[model samples]
Target: MSFTGSLVLSGIGGLVYKYGGQQSERETEVPVGFQSLTIGFFQARIRVFRTRLETLSRTFWRQLVETSGYKYPIRGVSEMFRSGAYFFPWARAFAFYLVLYLTIAFIYFCTILPVYLALLAFLGPIGFAIAYLHFLLHSNMLTMMVMRFTQLHNSLFDLALVHNGKEIFVKTAIQSPTLPKRYYVPLNTYYFWLNYLPWRIFIFGFGFTVLIVLLLISFIPIIGPFIFNALISPFIARIYFSRFLRLKKLDNKQRNDEFYFNFGTYVSFGFVAGQLEILPFVSGLIYSSNSVGGGLFAIKALDSEHAAAPSGATAAATAAVSGSQARQDTTVA
Candidate 1:
């Protein structure tokens, strides 16, 4: 993983050194493949799913090496907090929440009631601003953390894991039972309401569906959570890849898997990850690592069903062969 991460970084760094100079205007185009209309939407989506499965199996060798999914999320988050890059997002978010709260309070009490009612007119601007601030926190750290871990995930295969931040379009982990000692954040203790007080009330909140999904399946039986977990694992992986990881979205599956899939893993990874999201300054830091966790989950899920990757084939070269094989196998019964 280290070797592959280094190689991916080195390759990107070399590109940056060559063509990555800072410029005033910034724009990059989304790849045009997935957005195009297809003849059999279901069939096209199935083929794409097979391709993605093959890609991860062929590419995510490093992830395959791990016996536990909890390791990377733990370490990545620890590094984030230990270094203190995780706090900025929450601080910004809570600050906005506070200011907005106070402004409304003042309008309700301190100012004329009619004017306060009129001030309700500002909800559009205020709402947009609030959502924007929350969105702001998860993304910057997210893009870097995701791409790096992606390289790490695919390290053994060494496919060209290069990601241009341009592919980071609008969004999007599961771990086992581990009970920790009662704990709390150091400085930002007050911000915990982002998780507890507001259930989808906050403009920046990201875990509503996880709770819904978990509840939806809770009556089914013991395996409900795990059942939903496996069912939604690919969606979770793609979210990690595209949203927090800021990579391009993997498959065009809008036509299928809607009920079980989400760009945000809300209950599985998002719920677990959000435990730290209310921790003010470190929220984004901890949240950004969720992608790796999600990737590892997806890698484990897929590899369990597929054969081993070929030895000594550079993944970049063999991916075509692998994809072709997957397509040919489409007709297999």
Candidate 2:
């Protein structure tokens, strides 16, 4: 059977098992007639199962939004840019450059591919295969570079926040004493690219298949096309986050917080990318830079420990004075 068919059958079996089991239990406990008991139990189970499925669906969406990638809203991006935040403008500019480069590359590919195919007949299939492989390698390298850029942005912000004495209250904040500089390089350029070979191929194949399916289905009327295409946004976000999470620089807590906090932003960015593929570069740069600025703010807050300490010190002095007064009373008595 097809994968979708199998999934449907599994779902059906699960429902049957749940209802049948519940009916059996009810029949034994409730002193009602077996027929009535069975019917009531089945109805109750269906209601419960439906409620559970709905809840699960909602939770999945929430997770997709919350734990995806660079979670900053566009308004946050604008605010950071207006404030002359050091990271924001650079990130935005970088994003634009990256998008421009990608556009040019696509144009080149479209023009060159037909000529290459025609020439390959005179040349050999092996030469064409090698060229195609090289292209794939470069594409993977680009993806890795993007991931590194994200990591660097996050790291810079994290460091800035810590330095500033901010009470950075992300759920995960275990500090990394050292950062691996090599991990930030593009995949093809990395020394250990082979290590990720299996997973990379699997991910690429899955993504390619999904994209084809979405493109095919996206021509349908009303909700059909939009809904299928919408799936691409979350998938992109998921892949980006998965890459970000694999970075060695972040501690577990920081990674978790980053994943959860940035999911919505990632999803939004993905949706934007699907409609306008060039947007990812610009969005990535802006979001990463904003995060860096926020991190700096956090560091500044952390650094201002003097403000926090004075309140505690003052309270301690007050307690000491009260203690002295009590001692004097005791001595006098």
Candidate 3:
């Protein structure tokens, strides 16, 4: 696989690791595309589930307040849950946008490109290179956005766990809510260079060198191309994965563990998906869809639990305060 392809595959694996365990085992057999839709459906379900959880959380909070004689504030918790819920739909929309854009870009490149080049006088290597660069830049932007969305999702998970008195696995191996700042700052800095002038010149020069090497090695038969790629692929993937691990909040030790674990899982899943992709009917679709659906279900459940606990506590406190005030007024009168 290409460097970008590996990164994308690894990302999917990481997401599954983060959320897939919560889904029913039966639901995990479907393919990714189907699973993606199921995830969207589950996302909708989570919205509803979140509402119910919010109600329950408020109630639980009220009870806690009464029992402990503590103040439970509903406003802040309600607002936070509301914001978190908004993120789900926003993420869904963003995912759709990426899918749509990729489809359009593919069509333009494959279908329109040849025709446009034939008709235009200026269609040449320079034009093609520019177009390719544009695609690469756009892909990078999409990747950054996806990372940000995942971070937001993780934050929501943390809030939910904290609210519910659940212990979050906060060790190095886990993606913590605390890691985005460290990764994003550096990533954004790199991204700025990636998009700017001198860097693009450097990339073009590097790409030309690589192209020349590939052309030279093409004379050495099929094995030469494979050998070149094999040498380069691991280095590229390692750098990308390292950045990804940092972004996902894994420290050095944790990242090393997850790198091996996720790399193995990714290869396994990719093999299965690739095989299914070549199959006659809906086999691949079924597999991918199920995984995505299960993941969505799991995330929804976690968020529901988190939102419920806090809301429940707040509700209990409100009830207690109202009761206390009523009794005090009666006694005074």
Scored by lDDT, the top model is: 2
Off by over 4 Å in 1: 1-67, 71-73, 85-90, 93-240, 243-271, 274-316, 323-333
For model 3, give the 10-residue run with minimal summed lDDT: 68-77
**Model 2 residue 179 CA deviation in Å:** 7.6
- Top-TM-score structure, candidate number: 2
Clashes of 3: 31
lDDT of 2 at 263: 46
TM-score between candidate 1 and the true structure: 0.30
List where candidate 2 sits over 4 angstroms from the true fold: 1-58, 61-71, 87-152, 155-175, 178-208, 211-230, 235-333
Candidate 1 lDDT score relative to the true structure: 0.35
1 against 2, candidate with superior lDDT:
2
lDDT of 3: 0.37
In candidate 3, position 263 carries an lDDT of 42
Candidate RMSDs in order: 19.6, 20.0, 23.7
10 residues in a row with least lDDT, candidate 2:
21-30
Give the Cα lDDT of each candidate. 0.35, 0.41, 0.37
Give TM-scores for every candidate, taking all chains together and pairing residue i with residue i. Answer: 0.30, 0.35, 0.26
Clashing pairs in 1: 86-281, 86-282, 87-281, 87-282, 173-269, 210-266, 210-267
lDDT of 3 by residue, 62-151 (tens): 432332211111222243334444345435534644553465446545653454345443767765664454444333322332332233
Residue 189 miss distance in model 2 (angstroms): 31
